[model samples]
Target: MSQLAQDRGISVDHGTAEDLPLTTNEIDLAALLGVIGYVNDLEMVFSELARVVSPDGHAIVPFCGQMVLFAELYDTAAGQEAYPDTLDWKETYPLEMAKKATWRDVEAVVSELQSVGFTEITTVKTLTQPIETAIETVESPSKGHDDGSWIVVHARRE
Candidate 1:
């Protein structure tokens, strides 16, 4: 992905969330999609985000809740029981990633962002799935984190 971006004359820096390669207040925006669960230190990552983004800059972070993992587990178990010998029964990458992830709920994420001096925090609940289905579907985004498995949080640096 970095190579593809570079080919299009877009500069990209490889760095961790806890330690960005850019100078303080160097960027106006940071988008961390599907990254919150994988990061080891939320505080450090948010601190670095606050350090790098200019005043009043925005950070967009999208993450899935722990319920998604439960849903995945249920699906896996059902698949195994239904197929028995027919199914591969091998561990998939998504399942492994979920197992290794550090799950955080919406409130915890909001608090961390606030602690790092971010303001105007807004959460939009999206990708609502009542139960895990064979066919994936997307629903319209709503205002809060009440029903969706996936949520997108937007915050502005203070």
Candidate 2:
């Protein structure tokens, strides 16, 4: 990952979520994609985000909710799995990493962000249907979290 960033002239810093290796107010944007489910200490992570991001900056967090897991289980039981093709889509960390993940709901995420001094919270929902239909919604993500297995939450640091 660092190599790819370096190739594009982008500097990358490595650190755990609870103890980010960054100075206070150091960055204008913090993207926590696919991170909420894996972190054991969300409060510390959010605190670090609050400390490092500049005031009025933004944080974007994308996550797959627990409902997705249920759907996958259902598909598997029906012998119609939907994730086989995606398993090798990218080289990822070991499967052991999944053991640490705990799916969180959209409201919980929003509340966490707000507790950390973030505001203007909004959500973009996707994956409300099968892959084909879901792809179409990507260009115009629905508002709110009533119908999506995947969601992206956008918030601004206050």
The candidate scoring highest on TM-score is 1
Candidate 1 local lDDT, 20-59, one digit each (tens): 8999999899988878888889999999999999999999
**Candidate 1 clash figure, as a count:** 0
Write the residue-wise lDDT of candidate 2 on 1-158 in tens digits.
89999999998888988899999999999999888888988888999999999999999998877657434433453354233554433443334444455777778888989999999999987777765445444545789877777789999999
TM-score of 2: 0.78
TM-score list, all predictions: 0.81, 0.78
RMSD of each: 4.3, 4.4
The local distance difference test score of each candidate is 0.77, 0.77
Clashing residue pairs in all predictions, respectively, total 0, 0
Clashing pairs in 2: none
Candidate 2 CA-lDDT value: 0.77
